[model samples]
Target chain A: MRIVVLAGGIGGARFLRGLKAAAPDAEITVIGNTGDDIHLFGLKVCPDLDTVMYTLGGGIHEEQGWGRADESFTVKEELAAYGVGPEWFGLGDRDFATHIVRTQMIDAGYPLSAVTEALCARWRPGVRLIPMSDDRVETHVVIDTPEEGRKAVHFQEYWVRLHASVPAQAILPVGAETAKPAPGVLQAIGEADLVLFPPSNPVVSIGTILAVPGIRAAIAEAGVPVVGLSPIIGGAPVRGMADKVLAAVGVESTAAAVAAHYGSGLLDGWLVDTSDAAAVAEVEAAGIRCRAVPLLMTDVEAAAAMAREALELAEEVR
Target chain B: MRIVVLAGGIGGARFLRGLKAAAPDAEITVIGNTGDDIHLFGLKVCPDLDTVMYTLGGGIHEEQGWGRADESFTVKEELAAYGVGPEWFGLGDRDFATHIVRTQMIDAGYPLSAVTEALCARWRPGVRLIPMSDDRVETHVVIDTPEEGRKAVHFQEYWVRLHASVPAQAILPVGAETAKPAPGVLQAIGEADLVLFPPSNPVVSIGTILAVPGIRAAIAEAGVPVVGLSPIIGGAPVRGMADKVLAAVGVESTAAAVAAHYGSGLLDGWLVDTSDAAAVAEVEAAGIRCRAVPLLMTDVEAAAAMAREALELAEEVR
Candidate 1:
C-alpha cells in the first residue's frame, strides 16, 4: 500500500510513528509543513520537518516529541553569551548540526527538497519526506499588544516565545501565495492509494501547506480517499495551541467545526475522539463521512489502533 | 601613546597579552593575519583574529593559547555524527557561536571589519583588532605528496591535517595581490607612535599582511620606528612550525636571516634572544639596530619583558 501523510510538528510526527507501526510494509511519503521554517543565526530551521524526521528516525527526545535526544545546549548558551538571541527557541547542539548542514547545502544552491533528501540519507527516516514547498513560506501571526498594538510576528515568536497566550488577530503564511509545492509532493499525492492528514494544527500546520498555490488543489483532485484525524479532543487540542490558531482563522475549537472547515469537497472522512462521539453526526450531516474513535495517542499501541480506525474509515468512504 | 602590532595565531596572541601588560596606557591596534581564516561548515573561522580577541578578552584557553576556555565539542561531535566534516580542525561549541554570529552578519551585508568590531563589542578585547584585509585572502601552501603529486592546499590543511611535516614548495597568499588593507589598518600603521612585529610566523603570518597592495608601503613610509622580535629562538621557532614556511619563502630559519629578509629599510630594529646574541651584529651590520634580550615567553611577565625590550629598541632606533 502507498500512503501519503501531511504532517506538522509533534502531533503529526507521533501519529506517523503509529502509522508506520500499523503498516510496516506500506510505502509512506510524508509531505511535511514548511511554514514554521525560520532562519535563526543564519541557519535554516524547519521545526515541523525536523520533528517528523527525528521522530521517525529514533533520534527524537521521546518525552518532548520534538528536538533530538541526549542533546546539549552549549551552542545556544554560547550564542546567548555573545548577545545573539531569540533565546526563547531551544535549538540544542545536536539539532543545530542538522540546521547547519541544511543551511550549508541551501547556500551551495541546492533546493530545500534536495537538501531534505541528502539529510534523510543519514537519518534514514524510512519514509520519503518532502517539504510542502521549497520556496520560503513563513507563517506569521498578527496579535494586539498594549505596547506594540497590532503587529505580525513569526509563527515561532507567536507559538514558542509568547506561548500562544495572546489572542491572534490573524495568521498569515507570508509567501505561500507564490510558493510552489516541493518536488514530488503532487506526484506522491496522485500516486497514493490514500492520503492521511495526521492530527496536526489545522490553521498553521496543514493550513499553511494548503496555502501554497498548487498543493491544496492537487490534494483535492487526487482521486483517492482523503482522511483527517482531529487534533482537537473534546474541545481542547490533543497537543500544541491548535485552538488558538484555529480561532485566528475563525474556526471553532471542535472536531466537527475543524472537519467542516476542511469541507466535504476536500475531506472524504474525518475521525473524532470517542468523547466527541455526538459530533460525528454533525460532521456526517456536513456531507463528509465521520467516525468516533479513541484518538488519544497515549502510546504506540493506542496510536496504532487510531491509525487502523482512520484507514478503516478511509475504506468505508471509498 | 599609539602602538600597532602585526599578529598571527597563538604566538601573536600571547605576545599581545604581554604587550598589553607592558604598555597598559597605550592604545594598541592589531593588524590580525586573515591568511589563516577559513570557512568550515559554512561558518567563517577567523583563527588569528579570534585568538587575539579571546586572548585579550580573557576567554582563551590559557594552556592551549587559542580557542575558548571551558569549551564543549558537542557541535563538532554532532557534525561528525552527520558525516559532515573536515573532522580535523577542533571548533568547540562556544567557538561555533562566534562563527555563526560572524557568518550571519556577513550574510546580512556587513563587511568582516564591521563584523569583527561587532564581535569585539562583546569580547571587549581592549585592542582595536582589525583583519589585515576585509577581502578574502587565504594562505595556500604547495606541497608534493606521493599520492596527489604537487598541489596547493589551504594553510589549515597543510598545518592542521598534514601537521606541516611535508616540505612546503611555495607559500601563496591567494587573494593578497589585489586585496586592500581593511578599514583603519593602513591608517593605524601611518599614525602609530610605534609599530611591532611579535614572535609570529614571519613568512605566512606577517608576510601575508605585507603582501596586500598598500600595507607594506604604509608601514615603510611611516616615520615612526618599526621594530620586530625574532620568532626563531636560537635556531628553531619557540612554538609552531615556522621553519617549514620559512623554507618555502627561501629564508633560513635563523634570527639574523629573518631580520635580513625584512630588510633594514623596512625594519628599523630587530630583537633577538640572548642565545642568538652573536647574530645581533650581523643584523645591525645590515643597517638595522638589533637587541639581544631574553625572548622566551614562559609566562605573561616574561612576555611583558620582551614587549618592553621591543619598545626600548624602538626608542633606540628613534
Candidate 2:
C-alpha cells in the first residue's frame, strides 16, 4: 500500500512512527508542514520537517519527541552571549547543522524541496519526505496586547517564545495563497492508496498545508480514502496547545468538532480516542466514517495500533 | 601615545596582547587583515578579526592561539556527518556563532566595519578593531599541481587545506586594486603617533592590508614612526609558514630581506629576533633603523618586553 501522511512536529512525528511500524511494507510519502519554519540566526529552520526526519531516522530526543538526542546548546549559548536572540527557541548544536546545510543550499539557489531531499539523504528517513510547499509560507498569529494593541508575530515567536500565553485573535498562513504545492506533493496524494492526517495541529500545521492554493483541492479530488486522527482526546489536546489556535479558527477543542472541521468533503474516515468514544457517533452523523480507538501515543506500539485502526477504517469506508 | 597596529591571525593577536600589557594606557587602533576572510557554510568567517577579538577579550584558546576557549566541535562534526565540508578548517561551535552573527548582519546590509564594531561591543577587546577593507578582498594563491597545472585557490584552501605544502607561484590579493581602505583605516594610520607591524605574515597579512588603495600611502606619508617586527628570524618564520608566501612574492625569508621588502620609505625602524642580530647592520645599511631584540612571544610577559623594545626603538627613530 502507498500511504501519504501530512505531518506537523512532535505529535505528527509520533503518529507517523506508528504508521510506519503498522504498515511496514507500505510505501509512505510524508508531506511535512513547513508553516512553522523560521529563520533564526539567518539559517532556515523547518521545525516540523526536521521533527519528522529525526524521529523516523532514530535521532530524535525520545522524551521531548522533537530535536536531536544528545544535542548540545553551545552554538545557541554563544549566539545569546553575542546578544543575538529569540533565546526561547532551543536550537542545539547538532540541530543547527541541519539549518546550516539547509541555509547554504538554499542560498546556493537550490529549492527547499531539493534541500529537504539532500538532508533526508543523510537521515534515510525510509520515506519520501517533502515539505508542504517550497515557497515561503510562514504562519503568523495576531495577538492583542495591552502594550502593542495588536500585532502579528511569527508562529514560532507566538508558540515557542510567548508559549501562546496571549490569546490568538487570528492565525494567518501568510503567503499560502500564492504558494504552489511543492513538487511531488500532488502526485503523491494522487498516487497514494490512502491519505492520512496524523494528530497534528489542524489550524496551523496540516491546516496551513491545506491552505496552499492547489493542495486542498488536489487531496479532496484525489479519489483515495482520506482519513484523519484527532489531535484532541476527551476535549483536550493529546499534546501541544492545539486548542488555543483551534479557537482562533473558531473550531471547538473536541474530537467530533475537529472531524467536522476537516469535514466530509475532504475526510472519508476519522479516528477519535476511546476516552471520547461518544464523539464517533456525532462525527459519523456528519457524513464521515468514524471510529474510537486508543489514540494516545504513549509508545510506538500504541501508535501502531491506532495506525492499524485508521487503515482498517479506511478499508471499511472504501 | 596613540598607536596603530596592522594585524593578521594568531601571531598578530598574540603580539597585541603583549602590546596591550606593555602600554596599558596607549590608545591603540588595530587595522585587521580581512583578505583571509572566507564564506563557509554560507557564513562569513573572519579569522584574523576574530582572533584579535577573542585573544584580547580573554576568550581565546591559550594553547591553540585562536578560536574561543573551551570550544566544542559538535556543529562541525554534525556538518561532516551530513557530508557538507571543507572540514580541514576547524571552526568550533563558539567560532560559528561569530560567523553567523556577521553573515546575518552583512545580509541585512551592514558593512563589515559596522559589523566588526557591533561584535567588538561584545568582546570589548579594548583597542578599536577595524577590518582592512569593507569591500571583499580574498587572497588567492596560484599553485601548480601535476593534475591541475596552474590554478588560483582561495588562501584558506592553500593554508588550511593544503597546509601550504605546494609552492605558491603567485599570491594575488584579488579585488584589492580598486578596493578603498575601510573607514578609519587610513584615519587610524594618519592620526597615529606611531604605527607597529606585528610579526604577521608579510605576504598575505600585512601585505594584503597595504594593498588596499589608500592605506599604504597614508602610513608612508603620515610622518609617524612606522616600526615593524620581522616575522622572519634567522632564515625562517618564527611561527607559521610565512616563508612559502614570502618566496612567492620574490622576497627571501630573512630578517634583513624582509626589512628591505618593506623599504625605508614605508618603514622607519625594524626589530629582528636577537638570533638575527647580524641582519640588524644589513637592515641599517639599507637606510631603515634596525634593532635585535628577543622576539620570541613565549608568554605574555615576553611579548610585553618585545612591545617595550619596539616602542623604545620608535622613540629613538623619532
Candidate 3:
C-alpha cells in the first residue's frame, strides 16, 4: 500500500515511526510541515522537517523526541557570547550543521525540496520526505501583551521562546496563500491508497499544510480514505500546547471537536483515544467514520499499534 | 607613539602579541590582511582578521596559534557526515560562531569593516583593527597539475588543502586593482608615527595589504618610518610556507632579497634575524636602513624584544 502522511514535529514523528513499523511493506511519502521553519544565525531551520528526519534516522534525542542525540551547545553558547541571540531556541552544534547545509544549498539557488532531498540522502528516513511547500510559509502567532499591546511573532518565538505563555489572539500561516504545494506533495496525495494525519497540532502543523492553496483541494479530491488521529484525548492535548492554538482558531480542545474541525468534507475517518470513547458517536454523527483507540505513543510498539488501528479504520471507511 | 602594523594569520598574530607587550602605551592600529578570507560553508571565514582578534583577545589556541582555545569540531564533523566539505580547513564550533555572525551582518548589508568593528567590540583586542579593504580581494594561486594543466585555486585551498606542495606559477590578489582601501586603513597609515611589518608572509599577507589601491601610497607618502622584520630568518621562512609564494612574485626567499623587493621608497628600515647578519650590508646597499636582530618569536618575551629592536631601528632611521 502507498501511504501519504502529513507530519509536524515530535508527535507526528513518533506516529510516523509507528506507521512505518505497522505497514512495513507500504511505500510512505511524508509531507512535512515547514511553517515552523525559522532562520536563526542566518541559517534556515526547519524544526518539523528535521524532527521527522532525525527521529527516523536514529539521530533524534529519544527523551525529548526532537533534536539530535549527544548534541553539544558550543556553537549556541559561542553565538550567545557574541551577543547574537534568540537564545531560547536551543540549536545544538550538530543541529546547526543541518541548517548550514540547508541554508547553503538554498542560497545556492536550490529549492527547499531539492535541499530536503539532498539532506535526506544522508538521513535515509526510509520514506520519501518532502516539505509541504518549497516557498516560504512561516506560521506567525498574534499575541496580546501589556508591553507590546498586540503583535505577530514567528511561530518559533511564540512556541519555543515564549513557551506559548501568552494567549494567541490569532494564528496566521503567512505566505501560505501564494505558496504552491512542493513538487511531490499533490502527486503523493493523488497516488496514495490512503492519506493519514498523525496526531499533530491541527492549527499550525497539519493545518498550515492544508492552508497552502492547492494542497487541501488535492487531498479532498484524492479519492482515497483520508484518516486523522486526534492530538487531543479526553479534553486535553496528549503532548504539546495544541489547546492554546486550538483556542486561537476557536476549536474546543476535544477529540470530537477536532474531528469536526477537519470536517467530513476532507476527513473520511477519525481516531480518538479510548479515553474519549464517548466522543466517537458525536464524530460519526457528523458523517465521518470514527473509532476510539489507545492513541498514546508511549513507545514504538504503542505507536505501531495506533498506526495499525488507523489503517484498520481507513479500511473500514473504504 | 602611534604605530601601524600590517598583519596576516599566525605569524602576524604572534608578532602582535610581542608588539603589544613592547609598546604598552603606543597607540597601535592594525591593518589586517583580508585576501586570505574565504567563504566556507556559506559563511565568511576571515582567517587573518580572526587570527589577530583571537590571539589578542586570549581566545586563540596557544599550540595551534589560530582558532579558539578549548575548541570542539562537532560542527565540522557533522558537516562531513552530511558529505558537505572542503574539510581540510579546521573550523571548530567556536570559530563557526564568528563566521556566522560576520556572514549575517554582511548579508544584512553591513560592510566587512563595520562587522569587524562590531566583532572587536566583543573581543576588545586593544588595538583598532581594520581590514585592508572592505571589497573582496581573494588571493588566487596559479598552479599546474598533470591532470588539470593550470588553474587558479583559492589561497586557502592552496595553503590548507594542497599544503602549498605544488609550485605556484603566479600569485594574484584577484580584485585588488579595483578595490579601494577600507575605511581608516589609509588614515591610520597617514596618521602613524611609524609603521611596522610583522614576520608575516611577504607575498600573500603584507603583499596583499599593499595591493589595496591607496594604502601603499598612503604609507609611502606618510613620511613615517616604515620598518619591517623579515619573515625569512636565514634562507627560509621562520614558519609557514612563505617561500613557495615569494617565488611566484619572482622574489627570492632571503632576508636581503625581500628588503630589495619592498625597495627603499616604501621601506625605511629592515630587520633580519641575527643569523642573516652578513646580508645586512646588501639590504643597506638597496638604500633602506638594515639591522640584524634575534627575530625568532619563540615566546611573547622574545617577540617583545624583537619589537623593541624594530622600534629602536625606526628611531635610528628617523
Error of 3 at A62 (Å): 0.5
What is the C-alpha DockQ of each candidate? 0.81, 0.94, 0.93
lDDT of 2 at A266: 97
List the candidate 1 regions with Cα displacement exceeding 4 Å: none
lDDT by residue (A1-318, candidate 2, tens digit) is: 999999999988899889889999999999999999999989999999999999999999999988999999998998899899979999999999999999999999999999999999999988999999999999999999899899999999999888888899999999999999999999999999999999999989999999998889889998889999999999999888989999998999999999999999999999999899988889989999998888889999998998999999999988
Worst 10 residues of 1 chain B by lDDT: B73-82
What fraction of native interface contacts is shared by candidate 2? 0.94
Compared with the true structure, all predictions reach lDDT values of 0.93, 0.94, 0.95
Q: Pull out the clashing pairs in model 2.
A: none
Model 1 agreement with the true structure over A186-261: per-residue lDDT tens digits = 9998899999999999999999988998888888998889999999998999988888999998999999999999
Clash pairs of candidate 3? none
Local error of candidate 3 at A310, Å?
0.5
Q: Rank the candidates by lDDT, best first.
A: 3, 2, 1
- When just chain B is superposed on the true chain B, each candidate scores a TM-score of 0.99, 0.99, 0.99
Model number with the top lDDT: 3
Ranking by DockQ: 2, 3, 1
What does the lDDT read for residue B304 in candidate 2?
Answer: 96
TM-score for each prediction? 0.98, 0.99, 0.99
Model 2 interface DockQ: 0.94
